[model samples]
Target: MSAAHNASYLSRIKPGWKFGSLLVLSIGLYLISSWQVLLVAFILSVALLASARVDLKQLRAPLISIVIILGVVFILLGIQTNWLNAVSSVLRLLTMCLLAYSVSLSTRFSEMLELFQQVASPIRVVGGNPDQVALALSMTIRFIPELKKVYNEVREAQHARGLANNPLAVTVPLVIRSLKIADETAEALDARGFDSAPANH
Candidate 1:
């Protein structure tokens, strides 16, 4: 609420500062964290989360997903015969989840497209189709949340009918709906000019 706090939050929201810090943190933590150096990642994640200026409301989905994943991971890890390995597995999963959250919080869709374009340049020179590749990536990014919502709706409907406990209750409907969406999207794209052009390469 104070002016100093407000200013610091605004400063952290700047694009360049966020990207530079993420780059350094990702590389540094990735290198050292592989050797079980948790402090490096812990420090970086703490700093990144601290600097975040956005509303926590925007983080609801990721936070919920992380909680669900961590819950399942811990349950599975508990069933593992090796206690040390189980603990390590859970810790590593949580750490990776945190780092991914940091990246998502700081990065924008445009930045993601730019990064993917640059990374795909070499493959594009080869036999790859960057346009289609980018399209798929963007579609996946956009559709995943939509799919998740659809899944939740379907699951809730199933639960109301006493089928939620059934494994098929959740998966079969999700897959069927997703397939329908994919097929319709492909048909629409083809109806346009997506795949009409002759091969350039």
Candidate 2:
């Protein structure tokens, strides 16, 4: 998100509280089967987003992705069951995604790392390394936007070459770019001695 977005009300809220609320609400979304409830949740999310004052232009990519994903889900569910089931499922999933996107956009990268470490603390007893866990989680969260950029770049290139409708043209390059990112990430971790265990001396 742009620096201007940081001034938004939702962005100014404490990251922990925002994340916790999103987590709980996401879980609740899955438990409720009523389309009315899902529709209400979806509307609330949209209102919260507007209150955040985020630029609608910034949302274009994610909104497109959401439509594509939910369109597939709606089609599959319609084929498997009924239109009512499809609509409810798609709305519930979309609501959860919007809530997640809002939180991610609002929260800073450092706040996300701290939140992950806080969450991982309880798991330390079971051999978890909070620092590493936090780094991994933060990186994964940060990579989402980067991935979107890479995908758009690839799509534009393919479009220029008159392959805009070819799924393989997009998927192949996206996968390759993602793998390259993973490899670079591993190399950076290695350079930081991530693989070294604490000395017992």
TM-score of 1: 0.51
Winning model by lDDT:
2
Return the clash pairs for model 2, or none.
Answer: none
RMSD of 1: 7.6
Global local distance difference test of model 1: 0.65
For model 2, the superposed segments whose C-alpha errors exceed 4 Å read 1-4, 127-201
RMSD of 2: 7.0
Q: Name the runs in model 1 displaced over 4 angstroms.
A: 1-107, 196-201
What are the TM-scores, per candidate, against the unseen true structure? 0.51, 0.63
